[model samples]
Target: MLKMMTYFQGFSGHQSVPVTVDFPRSPPKLPSTSEAESETSMSEASSEDLVPPLEAGAALYREEEKAAKKKEKKKSKGLASVFSVFTKGKKKKGQPSSAEPEGAAGSRQGLDGPLPTVEELKAALERGRLEAARPLLALERELAAAAAGGASAEELVRRQSKVEALYELLRDQVLGVLRRPLEAAPERLRQALAVVAEQEREDRQAAAAAGPGTSALATTRPRRWLQLWRCGVAEAAEERMGGRPAEGAEVPESVFLHMGRTMKEDLEAVVERLKPLFPAEFGVVAAYAESYHQHFAAHVAATAQFELCERDTYMLLVWVQNLYPNDILNSPKLAGELQGVGLGSLLPPKQIRLLEATFLSNEAANVKELMTRALELEAQRWAQDMPPQRLDGHCHSELAIDIIQIISQAQVKAESITLDLGSQIRQVLLVELLAFLRSYQHDFNEFLERGKKLRSYRANVIANINNCLSFRTSMEQNWQVPQDTLSLLLGPLAELKSHGFSTLLQSLCEDLKPLFKRFSHTRWAVPMETLEKIIATVGVRLPEFSELQDCFREELVEAVHLHLVKEYIIQLSKRRLVLKTAEQQQQLAGHILANADAIQHFCTEHGSHATWLQPALPTLAEIIRLQDPSAIKIEVATYATSYPDFSKGHLSAILAIKGNLSNSDVKSIRSILDVSTGVQEPSRPLFSLIKVG
Candidate 1:
């Protein structure tokens, strides 16, 4: 069959091939068929004769299978190419299999042709076999290099720069793998550098924008570092020294220094630029300026130190003083410091005097001289027109002056000191007292005469009266009198006479009689009739006595003998005349009881003598003997007529007598002459008859 097929394949190539073929015996049975049918049969037989055609089909199938095998071989070769690229360390230059392959082909046909899982990519990166990642890495490197090289540079420069960039990126990645993780590192240094650079840039821009004169470079820059330093110092100082100091120690110096350096220029500029913004702070500055001079005086060679410490210290002081002026004033340490400096020595005499006066006024001696000195200093400071020093000087001077003025006006009267002095001194005091009283009255009257327009006139009058009374009381307590001189001096005053000086004198005597009695230890020796006669003689003529009758009747009478019934009829009549009302009579009775001796003496004087005594009877005889018959007769007649209820003529006759009498004598007479005609007659009938009607 092979030989035949071979020959047929050769013959076919040389000759024409049949269009149809059929089976002989089986096909002869179909001769009766029509020509079209025969043609159809021939067509069918041609379709059925497929042996050679099948062989042809088999050959085509084999060709298709061979073509598929060759395609698969090519695909395997492409896959091997990609796998080699991925697995190789570097591409071999001239090796066909190791040559650069198309990206899509490599990607599609490689062992890792499909999308890589995260683990695979990570493993690939970990292994440092980045041939698979080279293209991506190279692209990134190029971008970074371009960025680093800047757009203004050429391509070659960019490429050359890319090498360093790639190296740096790889180095970082390698280091990240080898060292501790980047998550552990701090980012602060980078951030800080960035901030610093940014600030520097801003500063430069600001400087460039500024005009020549306005430029911060020429002015502010020179002080910028200093300013920053000062600000830092100030903040630290404030933190340390913001509060009040401890008991004895002062504020820390750093605080003041910081404030001094930082705030001084700013403060001055603020004062110039915006004075109204900080009134209190400005005031503090002024106060500090003033206090600086005060504090400067204490330490030795203070001027040099002052120059050093002045500005800051002044600022601090001014701030404190303005806030608390009184507190500053009261600071004893500050005061002592000021005084030590002889600040007061610089003041004018007048100002010093004023200060001294004030100290004297307040009774503070220790500070008086200091005050005076301060005043002097103030004057000097003023004269110098040194405002910084003047305030303290003026304050001290004014304070001293005020103190002195107050003290000078507080003097007490000399009479208040009378008790400390002797009677001789008292007598002088009394004279002074009298003079003062008189002057006071004169002044008061003058004040009134001056139109009574003065507000203090009445007050002066009252004060004078009080002073006079006080003087009198003082004199009475201190005055020493001889026993013999007592009666002689007081006799006339004891008499209750008329409304004149005698009355006043008599009141004084009466008031003083008991004091005398206590000293004498005896009854008064002077006859009551004599006292009466004296009072009657002196009363009308004494100015006080007359004035007393008009202005002070009751006090005037009380001032004289408190009891007048024991004396002569004139005394009784005067007492009755002065004390005419029922109330006055009752008060007089009470007074008599209070002063029994005086009352007895007065009664006995009036009861023993008649009111109408003989004109020839010497006043001395009547006073001594209590024998004024006419005075007695008049008293007896009046008593009988006045007391009709008492029918005892003897008692009535005794009562009528105008000389001092005792209460016992009157009682005895009343008992003996009770209603009986025999006892009704006077005991001294002869004397009574001598003045009978």
Candidate 2:
């Protein structure tokens, strides 16, 4: 029967079954059986009896078992309910739920409490109490859930109020998270969130102060606010880490942003604030701001390393520039500072040129001072192993000129300048001038050689010349002219004039001569025409010879003209007799023959015959005494016939054919003379000599 009951009850057959079973009634009951009796009785039951009894018992037991299982499941479910109730009761012990109606719950919570409208919600948010409105929010949620179809007006207000309250609550929570003591918050998140929040506040403030009437306020607030942020970040960072960030620690992005904003909005304010606190940091910030303004951040970044007191350095440089504008022009240090700050690379070429001019100008005064400063700086830099600044070749040239000028001007002012100073100054000036000359010499040569315009070259050369001349004159007047000055002043001018004239002549010979030759061959009388052109172009102006004009005298002029004529005639006569080859002799003879009449006319007009006869009368008389044909010389005979009273020695010397010529040649000369007056015809042969003589 137990087996049957077990089978009916859905138990595995291997397990022993109990002989009695109990069922639920209106009241509960307990089964009465000893533990061992129940076990033995379960074993004695026969299969048939057990089967049928077990079937009936199993059916009842099965139903009872199902009921008990259901009850146990219910008990397990009730444990969860008990735990939830217990937890709720515990939580409620500290805080109680209010007894407000569902529709009014959100409003009664004090945040969204029946303050009546959107305006109140905003007011509540402004007052910063949105977190306290949880009850009113719950009421609104209930109202929305209950009115699933559509909300009534009152329900809508409750819902809206709930929304407003929740919004305020969220905003407050976000702000609270941001405002949490930085130390109490997680570092990364706190800093990031704080930055965002602070930025938002600044933006709002800026907007508020942005209108025309409020621009000053807006402008000032951002700078103050940024400084506040920087300080806050520094303080927060310090508090969190037990000190300020380690030296060279990367400034937090928040701090950098704060600084940037401050600089952008209120540069002066930031500058003022930073001036005292962290000078280097201020310098860096100011430099960055300047670069930002000038749009040269990239250049600055590439060129400079960030440092502690760089901002002060930058400010000092800027202040110096403003204080002494001329200093920037004169002092390379001012420019170098700007370059160090990355202004050099950023400045345009034109601006760079302008800066160069400034440096040159500033250095114009007391050049020694400028040079000494430059040298000292250079030495210091070298000693420190620092890279050089942005000085160029032009700077050196300008500095050199300035020094020379200073020395020159000082020497000029001194009544009795020392020889040493004068020598040094003169040497310096010469070197500088030479450098200028060397640079332009090629240009001047080109002008002379190619016949090009030389205005520019001339201008430079003239200026230098005038300067040297003035210096020399000054020295002479002061009666302190040094040997060197005199040498430079006098020697160079002569050399220059000679060189200039030589160069001009050589150019004429090379370039103009060929042209002249071509035109002379091709055109009628082009030689004379070209000669005139040459004279017009290069002939020294006679009027400009002031010394000659000032000392002019009539006797002097007459004596010079007479000497010139005599020299010309003597030279012509010598040339006529010196023809070597027969062809040259014949050529000369032909020229003499062709112009004989003209020459005779010129001699007659000038009374050259009368002058010649007067000097040779004695020589003619002596020659006339020797009437030898083979041994009586024909020259002696001709002289005797032409000037009977002249000496033989004089006649022989004047004829100049003392030995080689034959009698026929000497007689040919005599045939051209005018015998009646002992005078030779001016146009006739002045001499007759064979080629050998």
Residue-by-residue lDDT tens digits, candidate 1, 1-693: 001001012111233332111101110111111233223433332333111111112234345545545443544343334335444334445332212332322232223233332222222233232232433233433443454455443443333333223222222232221111111112211221222222233345446645533210112111122123223323323332233334544433433333322222222322342223322312323333233323322211222234333233323332232212222222332343223333232223453344333322332332243334543453343334332212311111232233233222221111111222122233332333333333333433443345233443322222222223333333344345455543433332222122222322544556534433331232223344344454553344334322221223334443233223223322322211222243433443433333444433442343323222221122212222233344533443344433332244423342433234455545554553244333254532222322211
Candidates' C-alpha lDDT: 0.31, 0.33
Give model 1's TM-score versus the native structure. Answer: 0.19
How many Å off is the CA of 189 in candidate 1? Answer: 41
Summing lDDT over every window of 10 consecutive residues in candidate 2, give the lowest-scoring window.
Answer: 1-10
By summed lDDT, the worst window of 10 consecutive residues in model 1 runs over 1-10
Candidate 2 Cα errors over 4 Å, as ranges? 1-228, 231-265, 269-299, 303-433, 442-494, 501-541, 544-693
Candidate 2 lDDT over residue span 1-693, tens digit each? 001000011111223322211111111111221323323333343221111111122234235445544543443332323223222223233333322222332232333213233333333233332222343234334544455555565544444433433333333333333222221223322322333333344445445645443110102123232343334333322232222234665433222222222222233322333233332422433443343434323322322234324232222222222212222211332233334443333334453344333433332333444434543443343334332222321111122233334445534422122234344445444444443334334333444444334333322222222333343354466434568755654554444433443442343344434433432254322333443443343223222211121112121222222322232223232322332244443343333233333333333443234343232323322332333444335455554554444333333333442234455755555444334344443332233221111
TM-score of 2: 0.20
